[model samples]
Target: MPTITTADGTEIYYQDHGQGRPVVLSHGWPLCSDAWEHELKVLADHGYRAIAHDRRGHGRSTRTSAGHDMDTYAADLATLVEALDLTDLAVVGHSTGGGEVVRYAARHGAGRVTKVVTAGAVPPVMLQSPANPEGTPIEAFDGIRAGVLADRSQFYQDLAVPFFGANREGSTVSQGQRDDFWRQGMLAGLQAAYDCVKVFSETDFTEDLKALDVPILIAHGDDDQIVPIAAAAYRAIDLVRLGTLRVYPGAPHGIVGAYQEAFLADVLEFLAD
Candidate 1:
């Protein structure tokens, strides 16, 4: 397991495979680099250098009780990319990872990156405010915080129900899927996971999205119950100067696995363009 030591001395675990144009993957909330297993193999086999990392306090990375915010997340990724001496690469982020990459591009500049892909990501903003009146209510995020504080394990188990689109009509969630979700969630530090809920939901990425000069591919499921396309992906596309939005019909938030083939094809297509 290769790891990079950030400026803060946190050992960030990551996977780098194959060669060619680098394609770094940033996994969703509470999940680790393991969540990108399918994408990693596919991208590598397709002659692309696929990279995925466990955010600090998640998976094999160092577990800490502090620095679990958007800025820290973006800085951790910047450190990894620089340490690896990667440039002109494609960054693909899902859910919270979307927030991380968006902030990374805005804060760190687009010199190291060529393009960005956001799938079922949280951007522009997830919480409602006077400026963004249509965002998800603050109380909804508060309820999530309350749930995690109450019982972390049970809370993760429950969150998996909707995270994978299992709760949708005609949708089926396998035992393995639920187990995988729980397994990854359990691997993360409880405090980091809790803190991320606020980071993803409250942080404003409007300016970040607007600042991006590279082409952005926003692929999101219209049926996503976790992060609705309206408040997240749709709005994100409008803000970016060069952005293409693709709505996955009847797709869920966990489209990485839920719509794996389509997701990969779209990503590859975007990168090739």
Candidate 2:
């Protein structure tokens, strides 16, 4: 049970495996580091120092009510990096974690981060606004918040469909995958999970993207239902200083697992470059 205490005294549980250039993984909303089991094992087997942590109120970490925003999420990650003295890093983030990595580089500086991968990440803003008229509407996020409060169990069960494209024609998403997703969602604190909806949706990462200096690999499934490509990864590549795009045709937001081999190969290749 390896852990680190945040400035606010929240204990974050993390996994550190293998030994080589550190590759820290940041996960998405309502998911803990275990969601990254495949990646952790694979990256380590490939000869990299793989690491992941349970964000506050998610997984085995402190279920605190406050500090569920992107700033705090990034700060917590910083705490882990500094505590471990990790350097020359390759950081990977998914969904809301995508916003976290962007914020992390911007706020703490990318001097140590050598490379970054954001798969199915949310960035450059996900909310609908006058300037970003093509974004998802506020009501959709509100509905999410409402779902968390109303019936989170059922909501998670239902959400696994769109999140993983389980309902898509000829989809291979398994019942175990959906059940595991539900299990992870249930572990999160109700308050933290509820608060994160706003963090992922409303928190604009436009300036954060502009501020990041490291070379980033922007990977996303073309048909991602959670974070649309046009509003997220597609537009995010244009905003970053140096970015490469890898689009998975007809894949869903969970492409990292859904297309595991391809995603792993792509990440390893980018990190090696």
Candidate 3:
């Protein structure tokens, strides 16, 4: 497996496919690069160099006990970009990956970036506070931490229901899809997976979003149960200087796979702009 060694010596695993302008993918929590497999194939076929990496402590990457926070996550991604010398890039992130992209663009600067896309992303903020009334309560995140510690396997199984909208009436989400979620969750490092709940839920990206100057596509499902649209994508777009919104009605949190065709089309169109 191909990998890059971060400044901290953490080995980050990655996949590179096709050949053209680069499109780097950042995946969500408790999941790895495999989550973006279909998107990569489609992107490569559409004439773009599609790449993805397993965030440190997830998938094939080193399962280090430290640096599970957002700052380090963005730095690791920055290392990947510099190592590959990718330029005029389009960075696409999903869920937790979305927040990473926001921080990356803000912290490292977008001098080499051309465009950005986030799907069902957690940003602006996810934790309830005086500034964010629409956000979820801290007790809810505490419940997630408990779930991770008490029964990760069962927790992942149950999370897949809402993550992919498998529980919704007339939903076409397959048993395999839910099983896939569990499989991915099981592959992640326990420490990293547990620590990520706080990273995604509590980290405020208001300043980061405001710092991005490149065009951004903020896509969110109206019915996303994990990260509500009102608090995440809705507020995120407002914070970014140049942001566009794509509302997926009746879509779940996993809109990328649930609405693959539409999502891909929207992404390609935005990239071509």
Candidate 4:
């Protein structure tokens, strides 16, 4: 497996495929680059170079007990991009990855970034505070942390039902799909997964979102149960200067896979414009 050494000396695994305009994908929390496998293949076939990396404690990357916060996450990505010497890149991030991309563009500067997209991203802050009354309560996140620590396997299994919107009355969820999600969740280290909860839930990206100068596309599902669109996706759209918002009605948080064709079309259109 190909890997890049971060500033903190952590070896992160990644996949680089195809050839054309470069697009780097970042996956959400508790999942690996495999989450973007479908998008990568589609983008690569459509004349784009696709690259994705497993975060420090997820997938095939080193399972460290520390450095699972947003700052470290963005830094690791910056290191990877610099190592590849990529320019005019379009960075697409989903869920937690969405927050990472926003922070990366703001912190590292957008000299090499051409465009950015955040799908079902948790940004502009997610945790509720006195100032941000609409954000998710910290208690909710505490429950998530406790659940994962108590019974990781069972908690992950239960998470799939809502994460993919399989709990919806007319939705269809396959055993294989659920198993694949579970398998990926189980592959990650416990400490990393636990710590990441705080990172994605509490890290404030308000300034980061406000600072991005490149074109940004915020695509989120209206029916997202994981990270509500109002507190996250919509908030990001309002903050970014050149951000465009697209809300998928009745779509779940996993809109990337659920509405693959439409999502790809929109992304291509944005990237083309």
TM for every model, in the order presented, reads 0.97, 0.98, 0.98, 0.97
Tens digit per residue, CA lDDT, model 3, 144-201: 9999999999999999999988778878888888898899888898999999999999
Clashing pairs in 2: none
TM-score of 2: 0.98
| Per-residue C-alpha lDDT of model 1 across residues 1-273, encoded as one tens digit per residue | 699999888999999989999989999988999999989999999999999999999999999878889999999999999998999889999999999999998888467998999999999899988887778999999998898889989998899888888888888668688889999999999888889899989999999999999999999998888898889987898899999988888888886444878989989999988
> After best superposition, candidate 4 residue 241: deviation in angstroms?
0.8
Candidate RMSDs in order: 1.1, 1.0, 0.9, 1.1
Model 3: per-residue Cα lDDT at residue 181: 84
Cα lDDT for residue 138, model 3?
97
- In candidate 3, list every pair of residues with a backbone clash: none
RMSD (CA, angstroms), candidate 4: 1.1
The number of the candidate with the highest lDDT is: 3
> Model 3 off-target regions past 4 Å?
256-258
Q: State the C-alpha lDDT per candidate.
A: 0.90, 0.89, 0.91, 0.88
lDDT of 2 by residue, 171-268 (tens): 88888988988999999999999999999998988888887788999999988999999999878988989899999888898754547678889898
Task: Estimate candidate 3's alpha-carbon lDDT, on a 0 to 1 scale.
Answer: 0.91
Candidate 2 runs further than 4 Å off: 256-258
Candidate ranking (lDDT, best to worst): 3, 1, 2, 4
